[model samples]
Target: MKEEMINIQDPILQLKDVSISYSPGKNAVKNIYADIAKNKITAIMGPSGCGKSTLLRAINRMHELYPDIKIMGEILLDGKNILKMNPMEVRRMAGMVFQRPNPFPTMSIFDNVIAGYKLNGISLSKSEKEEIVERCLTNVGLWNEVKDSLYKKGTFLSGGQQQRLCIARALALKPDVLLMDEPTSALDPIATNRIEELLLDLKQEFTIVIVTHNMSQAARISDYSMFMYLGELVEYDTTQTMFTNPKDKRTNEYLSGQFG
Candidate 1:
């Protein structure tokens, strides 16, 4: 089934003249202004070195973790500037998944799902933790596969299963937006397809912004698409329009067989 089209005005996250630099005098992301809609999937696609991952990190303030990195302009979540919010709070509001699945190797599958709350010093009863685990794992389609093995180490799962578990971990926090960087790139085709299906289902509850180099994957899952080149957002439109009738020549060239 086709996802409902989100009105452009309904933004959950907004970037206003946002720019990021790893060092003085060199910007990795430049003057980006885009609005991501609620309960929709947005794909950020560009060639290598195009600042896709850099911009994704900025949304949740991951850029602040590194020394010598600087960010300018506003990133708003529900009309509030995230730059002014506590980093931990920003991260809790917007969860992230990396290219590689990195569940805590020593932790059990069940423990990994509720690790966020534990690490953040948020207390919950055993029943509450169990409820969170089951709810999140079920949402990510991992509960059925790993229910009996909840006490086993997380690293024992396959790459796809581990990735799904990581997603469950993120979902346990009840985040409003999910930021994924090349989420399915490390998985096999079957696993990638499963993750894609999971993402489609997830958008009904969470706004998702995923960075993917795979054009076919972006076309398959994203409701809206953003094309970036040389640190600039070249075009943004509904996926249907961006793929079929992009307004920018650069977007057309990138969508075509020309330069990425």
Candidate 2:
């Protein structure tokens, strides 16, 4: 049977000839063009140094924080050029979670969740802050476990809990897109499973773009998959199709363990 094609109208974000370079004459990500569907989980997969994470960071302009990095082409979020928007606003709309759980050590559990607002100088009333804390924590499945100790330091929680706290922090902004860079790579099996479950549920509300090295994790959670190699995107298709029958030789080899 022939596979159904992805419709152009379904995309929430589109990358057009996107490329990134960390230094002169060296492109980390080269000429990537793809559409990310709304409210679906999209995984970017490749071996280390293949530019999966670089492309993920460029989605929200995270590379701008560094002086040496430069990006080319347009990354449109809902048809608006994200690079032209204010960096902070862009980040708020497309929040990120890193490889490690990086809850602020100096802040309490409650503060960590609302840190984005505070850092941005957005003042909230006591009641408003409380509402956000509860809502975001609950969103990440951490409210029940941490509610009693909301005032404790963020570092007080276990590794999994800290990761959840970081996720809660991002969710508090109510982002349109959530970008995760190997979010569960540092986690243990149980913790990773929990995060995977959380991501599955999250796709119902937000468009999720994740960079993952774990092939099985991508196969299990992503609705669409992009396979990159040596700074180039080799294939982008439905996860089932990409895994079962990739059109590109590189993608097939990578999936078959012949090369990465």
- Tell me the tens digit of each residue's lDDT in model 2 across 1-260: 21223445568898888889999889999887888899999999999999999999988888887999999988999889998999989999999999999999999999999999999999999999999999989888999999999999999998989998999999999999999999998899999999999999888889999999899999999999999999988888999999999999999999988876
lDDT of 1 at 200: 98
The lDDT values for all models are: 0.93, 0.91
For model 1, residues 65-128, the per-residue Cα lDDT tens digits are 7989999989999898999999999999999999999999989999999999999999999999
In the order shown, the candidates' Cα RMSDs to the true structure are 3.9, 2.9
Looking at candidate 2, what is the lDDT of residue 202?
Answer: 85
Candidate 2 TM-score over all chains jointly: 0.96
Q: How accurate is candidate 1 locally (lDDT)?
A: 0.93
Spell out the clash pairs found in candidate 1.
none
**Model 1 spans > 4 angstroms off:** 1-7
Q: What's the TM-score of each model vs. the native? A: 0.96, 0.96
